[model samples]
Target: MIAPLMKQAGRFSETTVDGEVVLLNLDDGAFFSLTGTAAEIWALIDGARNREAVIAELAARHNADHAAVAADLDPFLADLQARGFLAGA
Candidate 1:
């Protein structure tokens, strides 16, 4: 399965400023901004980490429970996929 944000890397222009991300969809001229935990998640999406890996790393970084992070993160990823910001498997 493709990492959710991998396939569409070419379709968006990503800019990071002060630990935040702004993604501009080239095809649609729509943009998305990421900050806080969202920015942290965006930084980990390197087209190599699977969903679990991403979650685990985030959990470790925050000394958080893996399941707890997943609870919030999975839905956010799904929303991004639905918005064409991510490529769902």
Candidate 2:
């Protein structure tokens, strides 16, 4: 089973500023900003890419350690999930 986190429909709007992705939640008018690698991660969650696929891409793109990136990604994704910015995995 390849489960991926999908961005919630009609829940948020986004803008990019100086390389950061700023997401605004429509429900509560909450604004969340994702920068650097986090922005890249956000771009990958389009209902097509799985978590491992995202981790792989991020690792290759940054020449980063896979485990380390995964460690960071998990919590960030969880935060997004908690905020209702994501539909589910």
Candidate 3:
């Protein structure tokens, strides 16, 4: 079976400055600021990878544990989705 993907949703504008990402949600006029690992995680959910794949890649890239990364990432992803920032979540 094909896995579910996390894809960007709604209309938005984003900019990166000093390694941090500032995102503006055009639909709702909400703004988000993502720094450090949060910025990295935002960049990874490009509609190409599933939740497990994202977790694995992040864990490997950061030399962190898969379970630990998943524990943190799951809630973050959910929040983004709940806020209409993500589709196919």
Residue-wise lDDT of candidate 3 within 5-86, one digit each (tens)?
A: 6556556778899998988888888998989888999998877788888898999999999999999998998877776678
For all predicted structures, in order, the TM-scores are 0.85, 0.89, 0.86
lDDT of prediction 2 = 0.89
Ranked by lDDT, the better of candidates 1 and 2 is 2
Give the per-residue lDDT of model 2 (tens digit) for 1-89: 78877998888899999999999989999999998778888999989898899999989999999999899989998899888888874
Error of 3 at 78 (Å): 0.6
Candidate that would win on lDDT: 2
lDDT of 1 at 49: 87
**Error in Å for residue 1 of model 3:** 3.4
Backbone clash numbers for all candidates listed: 0, 0, 0
Residue pairs in candidate 1 whose N, alpha carbon or C atoms collide under 3 angstroms = none
User: Which structure is stronger by TM-score: 2 or 3?
Assistant: 2
TM-score of 1: 0.85
lDDT of each: 0.81, 0.89, 0.83
Clash pairs, model 2 backbone: none
Stretches > 4 Å off in candidate 3:
none
